[model samples]
Target: MIRNEIKIKSEEGELFDKKQIALAIRNSTFEDDLKCSLLEDGILDKCQGCSLKYICNGIDQVVDSYMEKTTEIVNNFNFD
Candidate 1:
């Protein structure tokens, strides 16, 4: 995944290395599992009409705009 030196502090005030966190995240299937559960429960269907459907964590207008602009630019490109 992404590499960084960010340290995480636990509730017990103990600091841990970012490598441990990265390893845990890299080995986790939490996002796929959550998406599957939400789809089974019909939660994902509800998000179909939402404007922020592309965003998983939260609403980011900048990313949405960038995606739209990128798509438009790509569509206008002459690949032939």
Candidate 2:
């Protein structure tokens, strides 16, 4: 799917940062463990004040879960 489609499919449904999520996914390995650790361990703390934080938080209902949801979005991403 294209970036717009991905954004629409996301839980935030247009309220989040599709580009940031895409970038995070591209930067990550998408491994379950790593994703979990990133969220659980403050690895994404840099995103704390990001404008997309609400969308990211909406993805998992936890602001820190940005990496986890990003991985999920990337893993399930489809190209058309």
C-alpha TM-scores of all predictions: 0.23, 0.23
Off by over 4 Å in 2: 1-14, 30-33, 37-80
Task: Record all residue pairs in model 1 with backbone atoms less than 3 Å apart, i.e. clashing.
Answer: none
Please report, in order, the local distance difference test score of every candidate based on alpha carbons. Answer: 0.50, 0.52
Residue by residue across 2-35, what tens digits does model 1's lDDT show? 4354566679775778565444443343332223
In model 1, what is the error at residue 5, expressed in angstroms?
A: 19
What overall lDDT, based on C-alpha atoms, would model 2 receive against the true structure?
0.52
Which model scores highest in lDDT?
Answer: 2
Q: Highest TM-score among the candidates is held by which one?
A: 2
Where in model 1 is the C-alpha error above 4 Å? Answer: 1-25, 28-36, 57-80
